[model samples]
Target chain A: MGIQEQYRSEAAALLSSGEVKLVIGFGEGSTADRRRPLFARTPEEAQKFVLDAACIANLSTYLVTEGLLSDGKKVAVFLKPDGIRSVNILISEAQLKPDQVVILGYAIDKAEITALEGRNISDFSLGEEIRSHTPPPHILQEAERIEEMNPAERFEFWKAHFSKCIKCYACRQVCPMCYCRRCIVDVNQPQWVSTSSHTLGNFEWNIVRAFHLAGRCAACGACDRACPVNIPLRLVNYRMGKEVIDAFDYCAGENSSQKPVLASFKQDDPETFIL
Target chain B: MSEPFEPKIVAFVCTYCTYAGADLAGTSRLKYAPNVRIVRLPCTGRISPMFILKALQKGADTVLVSGCHPGDCHFTAGNYHARRRWTVFRALLAFTGIPEERIRFSWVSAAEGAKFAEMINEITEQTRKLGPFTQYQELQKVIETQSTY
Candidate 1:
């Protein structure tokens, strides 16, 4: 059977057997080429399940949405490797219980989608095998290009990019890890971050956005894809994530039991810069 | 001639170590540059990177984060955690083109009054040499001058 037929059958069985109350997958969007998130409760609804290159919404974000998890019903989500890593992070952080998530894993590149034989977050080790793959060449080149520039030129580069921010916050809204009840930008008591989209405020928002996800970001490129202004937010996140893994031998969501990189530290962490 | 440039500096220090060290420097008559204004917190771990950005946003040419030495945190391991955090935060700041020198991290124990004074003198002199942080200050000035519509 083709991959879409296989996905449809698996979703149907899970839903009809009452094993999963909801199967989150991709269905036809308003346009012929676009796909939207499909939440299926009945076996017939599960027939609409689609698997293709364009189904890249990282549906795990819905697993933590406002009213989804409160009911304690089991949820099965169609996932790519990036979505699987997000499940791992969410489970490790105690935000989502492992028993509550059933993952239908798959792999996708620019033009193809191939399903994997994993039904849960643990099935994909996400270990050295996954980490061995280097970052995309374009992101690497842009980061290195920025690194090679003089500090002033780099400053100007970022300033021009950040000045275009309209503070729509679609990036934050789409991020699975950005599950805070009240973000720092919303708190006005002393106002930890400015809410406006001015230059200084934009700088603070973008910096904090990247910093908050330094170690925890799943590197799913969801935020970058969601950015309205086309900011290279993933490159900054990739740089910080690389620093954590290189400096501390840590990779977020690689292992379910590992403590978060920033929350815990060793006695002998490198600190050459500190006086 | 116009007055020489004096860069404003903000020092976020732990009450247990660096703050006490600064107080000891004063009591011991140790001389240091008077450019820095100190904001005392409970421990180094309590000093969020946001504070550094806030200092710069409010016109401080440089920001200093001094805390207990490793294994000497008042809360036990706060400095260690802080050291790791600063390492990552400093790297992020540098990646964003915030000159690394503008954010200084150090460890100054209560008995290290001399070291505290000397470090302050060095940071103040370096910042003064770097001149005012015009890029960030320019952003702040624009936000202040603009009408809130």
Candidate 2:
């Protein structure tokens, strides 16, 4: 049997035996090249699970749905390394309990699908690998290209891209870390970020979003994919990520037990920028 | 001749240290640049990154964030935490193409009144040299002229 069949049987068994209350995987999407999240509550539903290279969405996001784990039953979800990293982050942030999630992990490389060696979060050694794994060359190259520009050119560069933002906030919607009950943009007390027609406010919205994710981004590329305007969201994320690593030697979601870089601080952490 | 441009500078200071430092500067009768308008907060940790951006949006030509030294935070670790935040936030600002020169950070204790006074004068002079910040404003005008609004 193929790997897909193997995972399907595994999912079916998990559901049938009541080992897990739900199996979240991919079903056939609208296009053959696409995959949609499939939630299997019963053994028959588990058979429809599609484990393939196209299953890219970080399914851990669904696990954060309000009250899903309130009753304390286990839910199994198929996850790539990035999705697993998201789980680690959520667990670290106290958003989800580690015992409540059972991750069925996979990886896709160059259109090839392969199973990652893990079930429980602790079963995998992802910290070292994620820290050492260099991001793709294009993101680095683009970041460098932007850095080479003068301040004026750089400002113009971002202004052109951000103005295209319709403020639809699909980027915020797709992110797992963005599980705020009330997002800052939605708060109107001071209304620092206006809700409408202020283009500068739109820029501020994107900047604030990127700022909030500085040391916390799971690097799942969800925001970049979700963006309708193709604003190089990853480029900004990569730059901020690089800053935390360079300044504090910190990597997000690298370890489940690791302290969040911003939340905790060392007295000796670099402050050269602080005059 | 037309009046010279006086760049608007907003300084966000921790009341425990920098604000006290500013108070000392005044009490000492030491003169500093009058260009700065200071907003006092409880601690440096209270200086949100949004405060800086909002200052810029509200027509400040530049912003200065000052707090206690690393170990001297009135809350014991507030400045240390604030230091880390500014490190990340300042980089994010630069990456988004905000001129790094436009945002400044410093350490000021209650004893550093002269330092505070001199630093404000220096910032005021430097901002005067840099002239008005029109980058965000120009973009604001871009959105303002659009018929979509």
Candidate 3:
């Protein structure tokens, strides 16, 4: 049987056996190639579950939606390796319960969706190999290209991109890691970040967004895909991710047991820049 | 005639150490550049990178973050944590193309009056040579004209 057929059958069995209250996966969009998230609660509803390259939305983000866990019911989510990393981050950050999520992992390369052989986040990996593997060359190339520029050119490049920001915050909405209840930008006591979408505010907002995800981005490309302006957010995020790996020997979502790179530091962490 | 550029500096200092250090500098009759405006916080741990960015956004040409030396934090380990944070933040600022000299991080204990004065003088000289931060100033000018209230 094809992988799609297999996924449908497995989702059906999970729903029929009451193993999970919900099976979150992709269903048809308005067109044949389009897909949207489907939450299947019944065995028949599981038939709508789709698996393909076009089903690229990181389904794990939905797992943390505000009301989904209110009933304390179990959920099964279709996840790629990057999505799995987000689940690991959520679990480690005490934002989600492990037992409550049954991950159905998969990976798509060259248009083939192959199911990953794992049911749990730790089943994902024991070290940085899985976390650092397979960063898309396109994103890495752009990040490197930016790094090659002179500081003034780099600033101008980012400023030009930021000036186009309309502040729709679609990037924030789609990121699985941007799960703050009260984002610093929203706090108004002293207004840390201005709310306007003008050049200054936009620069501050985008920089803060990237900084907040420094060591924690899953490199899932969701933010890049979600952006309506095509801001190349993944490149900025990839730059920060590379810095974290190079400096701290850390990768986000490697395992539930690993301390977050920013939260914990070694006494010997590089300090050559400090005076 | 337009006066020579004297860079405005904002120093976020911990009350226990760098603030006292500055006070000691004053008591010792040690004269330093008078361009810096100090905002005293309880510890270096209390200084957020946002405070640094905010100072720059408001037209300050340079920012200084000074506190107790490592293991000398009044609150114990506060400066250590601050050290790690500043390291990462400093890298972030540099990667974003902000000149490294614009953001200064140092340790000045309560007794280091002369050291504090010297550091200020050095920062003032360097920033004055670099002139005003026109990039953020231009952005701020645009923001003022737009006034999205």
Candidate 4:
């Protein structure tokens, strides 16, 4: 059976047995080209579960929104590798609990699963898919090149791009990791980011949003995908991801037990930049 | 529009090291740019990324974070944590197009009064060449106008 068929059956079995209150997965959208997030409450509904390249929505975002894991019921989530990482991070951040959610992982290929399990991927096809599916080349290249530029050039490049933003907040709304009950930008009293779509407010909003996700973002590409104007928002997150890894050898969501890089301290961490 | 530009520099100093170092600089009668306004925190670890952006939004042309040298932190590892956080924070700042020189991190022990003075001199001189942080100011204005609509 195909992976999708197996996942559907397993989810159905779990739901029918009352093992989980809800099984969050993907379903065929009204159109063939699209897929939508699915909340399977019954074994019969599990037939709607589908897994494909179009299943790109990070369903974990709904863990809070749809109240799937609420009411003190165990919720089961079907996670792709990226989704697994996001789930792990969310769990570590106390956003979700392990017993509260059960993860059913889906690998595009078996060898990819092996690699994730800390085993070598001997299958060339699986390896190729995983390699080709890594973060886009332009993001990696730009991240490296940006580090080489002097501060002024770096500032100019970002300002030029951010000036084009319309303050849609699509990036903020769509990010699975941005689950704050009230975002700083939305707070009116102190007025963190201006409520307008002007250049200064736009830039500040983008910067603040990105910084807020620092060391917590799983580099899931949801923000970039959700942007209406196609801002390369992941570039900011990816750049921070690289720095976190380089400076502390830390990767978000990789280990459920590890403390987040920004939230905790190590006596031996590098402080060469300190005065 | 040839107004004399005075860069607004926000310096986040850890109370243990750089904050004490700045006090020493003051007590020793050392001279440095008066452009910087210091925000003293218990440790570098307490300096959140929000504070940096807040400083920028409030019209700081540059933001500097100073703390104890690695392994020299009075809290034993506060500066180490700060370093890791700033490493990522700095990269995010750069990616957002904030000028790199506008944000910096340094280690200055309580005894390093001369280094603190030199650091300020360097940041002030570099910021002078880079000019004011107009991009953020311009955005702030737009945000203000939109809210009125």
Which whole-number lDDT from 0 to 100 does residue A118 have in model 1? Answer: 72
Estimate the TM-score of every prediction.
0.96, 0.97, 0.95, 0.84
Instruction: Return whichever of 1 and 4 wins on DockQ.
Output: 1
- Among incorrect, acceptable, medium and high, the docking class of model 3 is medium
- After superposition, the stretches of candidate 2 with alpha carbons farther than 4 Å from their true spots are B1-3, B146-149
Q: Whole-model Cα lDDT per candidate?
A: 0.88, 0.88, 0.85, 0.76
Candidate 1: clashing pairs of residues? none
Q: Which pairs, if any, clash in model 4?
A: A151-B100, A155-B97, A199-B139, A200-B139, A201-B139, A274-B106, A274-B107, A275-B106, A275-B107, A275-B108
lDDT of 1 at A86: 83
The fraction of reference A/B contacts recovered in model 2 reads 0.78
Worst 10-residue stretch by lDDT in candidate 1 chain B?
A: B140-149
A216-250, model 1: which lDDT tens digit per residue?
88888988988988889988999898889888888
Off by over 4 Å in 4: A66-70, A109-133, A141-153, B1-3, B71-76, B139-149
lDDT for residue A163 in candidate 1, whole number 0-100: 76
- Candidates 3 and 4: which is better by DockQ? 4
Give the worst 10-residue stretch by lDDT in candidate 3 chain A.
Answer: A126-135
lDDT by residue (A232-259, candidate 2, tens digit) is: 9988988888889899999998868888
Measured by TM-score, how close is model 2 to the native structure? 0.97
lDDT of 4 at A246: 71
Model with the higher TM-score, candidate 1 or 2: 2
lDDT of 4 at B110: 96
DockQ of 2: 0.74
Query: Which candidate number maximizes TM-score?
Result: 2
All candidates: CA RMSD in angstroms?
2.1, 1.5, 2.3, 4.8
